[model samples]
Target: MLQKRICIIDDDPIYKLITKKLIQKTKLYSETIEFNNGNEAIIYFEATSDLPDILLLDIEMPEMDGWEFLDEFCKLEKRINKESTVYIASSSIAIEDKLKAKEYKCVKEFLSKPINLDKLQKIAEQN
Candidate 1:
C-alpha cells in the first residue's frame, strides 16, 4: 500500500516537533513536510505537484495565518489532489473561528492545539 503524505503548517517549532512525532508513532504517513508559515507552504504547494493527503494548519503565524492560506489556496488554478484533506489545528476557542473553518470545503476537521494520538489515529483510520 502506498503510504499517505502529511503536511504540517505552523510557526511553532515545538508544536510541529511533537505533532510530527505523534503522527509518526501512528505510522500513518510515509512522509511529512513542515512549513514555518503559510506563505512558505503556499509557495511549495504552488510550485510542486506533490500535495499531501492531509494538511494540519495552524491559525496563528507570522507570515500568513490559516485563514489567509485558505484564501490563497482557493485561488489556485490547479485542483488539489482529490484525496487530499485539510484540518485546522489551532489553539483558538472562539466560536467565530470554528464557524469560519466550517466554511471551507477542504477542511475536514478543526482540531485543538496539542493534537492527541487518538485524534491522529482516527484521522489515519478514516483515510
Candidate 2:
C-alpha cells in the first residue's frame, strides 16, 4: 500500500489536533500538513512543487475562506497535480454551503466536522 500525504486547512486548532490523532489511527498517510487558513495553504502551494494527496478544508476561516481558496486553487490547477483531491470538512449544516461545494470540480466530497476514524480510512482507501 502506498502511503499518502494529507493536508488540513482550518482555523480551529482543536479540530486540527483531533483530526491529526484520528489520521494517525488510520495509519494510511505518511505525512500530514496543516494550515490555519486558506491563505496560508495557498501560499505554500504557490511556493512548493509538492502537494498533498488529500486536502480536508473548512468553509469558514480567517483571511481567505474555503470558497476563495477554491477559486485560487482552480487557477493553479494547470500547474499542480490533478490527483490531489479536496474534501470540504466543515461544521456547517447549511444546505446552501453543501450545494456551493459541489460547484468546485476539485472538491470530491463534503464531510461534516469531527471526522471519524472510519471516514478517514474510507477517504484514504478511495484516494
lDDT of 1 at 94: 96
Q: Work out the TM-score per prediction.
A: 0.92, 0.96
lDDT of 2: 0.93
- Give candidate 1's TM-score: 0.92
lDDT of 2 at 81: 55
Our model 1 lands, by Cα RMSD against the true structure, at 1.6
RMSD (Å) per prediction: 1.6, 0.9
- Whose TM-score is greatest here? 2
Question: Residue 112 of candidate 2: its Cα lDDT?
Answer: 96
lDDT of 1 by residue, 20-66 (tens): 99989988789999999999988998888567888999999998989
